[model samples]
Target: MDELFQQADRLSSSHIRDRIVEQLYKQSNQLIKAGVTFSKAQHNERTEKLDAIFTSPIFGFPIMLVMLGTVFYLTIAGANIPSSMLADFFGWVEGYLTVSFNNIGAPDWLHGVLVLGLYRGTSWVISVMLPPMAIFFPVFALLENYGYLPRVAFNMDRLFKTVGAHGKQSLTMAMGFGCNAAAVMSSRIIESPRERMLAILTNNFVPCNGRWGTLIILSSLFMASGFTGGMKSIVTTSVIVGIVIVGIMTTFLVSWLLSKTALKGVPTHYTLELPPYRKPKFFDTVVRSSLNKSLSVLYRAIKVAAPAGILTWVLANIQIGDTSILLYIVNFLDPLGQLIGLDGYILMAFLIGLPANEIVLPILLMGYLSTGSLMDVDGIEDLKQIFLDHGWTWITALNMMLFSLLHYPCGTTLINIYKETKSMKWTFWSFMIPTAIAFLVTFAVAQAALLFGWG
Candidate 1:
């Protein structure tokens, strides 16, 4: 047997593998012929029709877009009430904490740091992160449970192959919509080490649940001024869908670049079986997805966000000369931020929001309110008024959306990448690559807007 394997190895690997597969099929067919009816159709007609539509070269992508848009629509529309309730509950709790701290005669700075800073930060994260994750993950898991996820991978396999990455990267990218850190962990499903690393590096391109909350908020605000009725909802959903498509395109572009550069490799072929769709087990899916994906991600975000809240409070409160340290940092970052079509406050928010993407807008609102604390602005109209007061043009909103979509992964995701890759070098590149692309894309957009005098 060893000598026979050595002889087979002398031929081209592809040819040898093909011959082995042919021989195996030949033997299997001989036994199957004893009782099988060769004329009978193998698959159910309905299953075949569904696969034809879902995996069609032309209709496949559009179907995917429609489904994706529907999921986002449901998440955005459904999460609003829950998010508001959570925010209110957290705010009420914060009030009690503040009163208790004062009654205890805690130092003013300590009160600010603990109640106003740390408590508020964690609260904002939960209030913002939980609703979306709770809504998004179950719906996504439903698709997975119904076995449509593998079909998605099957459809995108050709494109990923072109980029020298595994088609399984699509599976991991889908996981990113729930949480990038989870997506990094999911990359283990890819058998190829190089492709797995590629997936980890590019997973940040997709807007995770935290970033989705920001995008949905901004997209709704953008639509509010010009659209109404069902049209408004349609337009808002379309805009978000468009942003998601752009992220996917960016993922492809970056994958192609990496394939040709430091991570050069040939794409490995793998078979993907599209399982028959079935009724999703609702209760099991909901329980498992909520506990496994939503709560797990929320816990990580809270861990990082607690310290971030205290740090943000310190920066906002501690003054240097005439400006607070927060303002000074914003001032220093202003020119670059302007070049990318954002303001000092916006940039500052992103910096401090490093702990969790869910906190970016909250931190920005805090800065804009100038209250030395994060304030929950009620309604899209109130949020719009704040932006208008701060001189936010549509261009500013648009560029910020673009930047948010393209920016580096949140701190939790970064840590996950480090742990998964077990290489600081790969992890650093994972950070730098996305940061570079984000700045370049935003800079070009900013320059184009300036040249065209776009609002």
Candidate 2:
């Protein structure tokens, strides 16, 4: 068996499988020409031309960048009015709910838990999550259904291979932009154990929907102080795309580091079948994406966040030695947080936000208010004001975005990681790798800003 395997290896060449595949297709074509009478598809030529441009060495990456930036820009801009409207609608409903609770003589804690905790959290998740996701998923789906995603993987395959990972990891990372848990599950596409693990561990570096919302707000701050009108959205999108690039770079770095250290192995090759690009039915694509990806994700987020809101409320209201349980946790973490250019509230938010990233900003706002109420701002203007009141500067905003980008997987994602790997040890490393990197990156930037007096 060993000698036979060695002989096969000696006879084989690089990309031998690809060559065999081509030869088989060529022979099949010959047999078809002799025995079959079917018209050749004209789209094959068209597809070849399209791939030539989309997969070209010169135009491929820039085109991909432009397409990606457009999707995100549309998502950011289109979501604004709808998100605001949803917030307003929810607030109106909350007012009526509050009146009903008061009329029913409900206890304050009961109202807080039911109305403020469960209902508010669920509504907030839907409002904030649904808008951007509604815009992003369908747009992304159009690209996918039209068969552009494979070209993305093709273009990125070499770079990932250079980092000792699979080319298909690019697709998983793209999935991460939607949800890291989904991305972690998507890593199953890469058959190599080492490469799949690399993909899973680094998936969090790609900001998920919740983190994207955080980035959008932070990126807007950069533009809010400067650019206006179209320039503002353009600049904001540019910053976000830049952050996305940063995340990709971090993915490569971590993948390479892990490949060299913990999971050292040779890279494996896999055949990628690029399907013919079909003009997708726009409305159908939108409907399917909305129902499958957007609504489902929103459902999961709300499920996780409602309980988180209850926990936050309980911690905020319950006091020990004149400090709320929430406050004590915040105070304990403040020094460490400050070392990373964040405050206690922001750090504690991330800890509690382990359950769902959707609740992080809300929890932070809750921590900021001494009234022990879960915070919900009316608009970005109000939210920005709250951050400013809390002494957040550009460094703070920058670090907050960075920390959010690099933090550990959300609770659902961590659970998915364990389930997928069925190994608690891998799950533990998946959590640790990102957390350590988040701290290191944020702490270094904070220290450097102080060193240069950026404040």
Candidate 3:
């Protein structure tokens, strides 16, 4: 029909696009007419052959739990010695620098900011961040390489759709493993405007690799005190994994709530194509997934962290009324932080961590070391002592982890949300809703803990 052709022409300029849609429609109709069915054994055989335990509800979540545990187990087990080594190495360097600065008659402020602030910041970054990232990313890549990741998506797809989001959001959330900004950008695959916006707003619930590093470290330090040997690793890893899973669950919960209220809609249907498993190329996976992802993200973090480090250093050294600027800021933030089971330093870390979640720990270290010129951390144990000295408790640490998992997208992700939505209102809400939810959830957690003996 001329009219039909005209309408089709208006809808699709490219022949291939129209043809593919037409073909898929035709095939779907044919299957429907045929009353598509397969034997129980046949279905079982298909699922079994695919080795989809990673997607089975009974086994999938447990697999995820184990995988996450293994990654953190490796990170905690691997990072302890290197973290101590780096700390001792850097402390010696700091002493050398301080002496050299005195000999050269360097200005007090100059020595303070450079040797105390910048050097300490960089040292904290290397000692705290390096080992975990080095171990986690490669293991994650191996899972990804083996086609297990898609199974994760498949397992979680139904949950995502129940929230009126694209099922593919599971895949995008998986992308958040490497970076939240990348995950937000990957939302373009969602064709619906409302669903896409939901994806952008909630993507932060999946901890980016940087935040994952922080959670792993903090959980190992704070939550593993009662256990020892392999059990310690298992417990620490389980806690971190539990936190990650909670984050993901929060994403779905928030998405569902938003869809029912502010962003309501039926989810669009899509068939996720599962590629066959292949032997992952070892050298290529290492180069592309592990080294490249880690280094690129680390480089971006250092740029932002360096300036914040300098600022915090200055705040620490400059005293007003016997209290430094850092203390003043922390005092100001403490009341609000109290409601959320965090303190000023924790809040400040999140604020300064705007540039990259990767830098939050580094920033916290910088803040702590502000009064001293010593840089570097001895180990998770030493880091725990520092946090404990500053009034950290199990509730505080748990809520901090929760807040990190639920809070606003990092600066990079906000920029990506803007690019994806091309609307400032959507971008603003994408930041707003998650922040509100993070506060509420954290507040509830804190209150509940205090109400019980748990706090």
**Most accurate candidate by TM-score:** 2
lDDT of 1 by residue, 1-455 (tens): 99998988788664676588769868977788777665434444566789989999999988898899899888877777898899888878877888898898999999888877788778878887788889889999999998788889989987998888998999999889887888999999899998998899999999888898788878888644698766677777888998899999999999999999988998887777677778899999999999988898888778877887787888888988878888888889899999998899899999888878888887787677664576656556887999999888887888888889999888888999999989999989888988899899989988999999997
lDDT of 1 at 182: 82
Tens digits of per-residue lDDT for model 3, 1-455: 99987877677333445478679979986886589764554554564576656566688878877776777678778876777787788888888998999999999999878877777777767766766677777777887887788887777776787778888888788888778998888888888888888888888888887786678777777787888787877887789778877887788788888889988778876766665576787788867765787787777777776777788888788899899988888889999999889988889889878878877877776677656344545555677888888888888888888888888888888888888888899889877877888899899998898899684
lDDT of 3 at 253: 83
The candidate 3 region of ten consecutive residues with least summed lDDT is 370-379
Give the Cα-based TM-score of candidate 2 against the true structure.
0.91
* Candidate 3 ranges with C-alpha deviation above 4 Å: 1-48, 369-377
Against the hidden reference, what TM-scores do the models get? 0.88, 0.91, 0.85
Better of 1 and 2 by TM-score: 2
Task: Give the Cα error of residue 62 in candidate 3, in Å.
Answer: 2.9
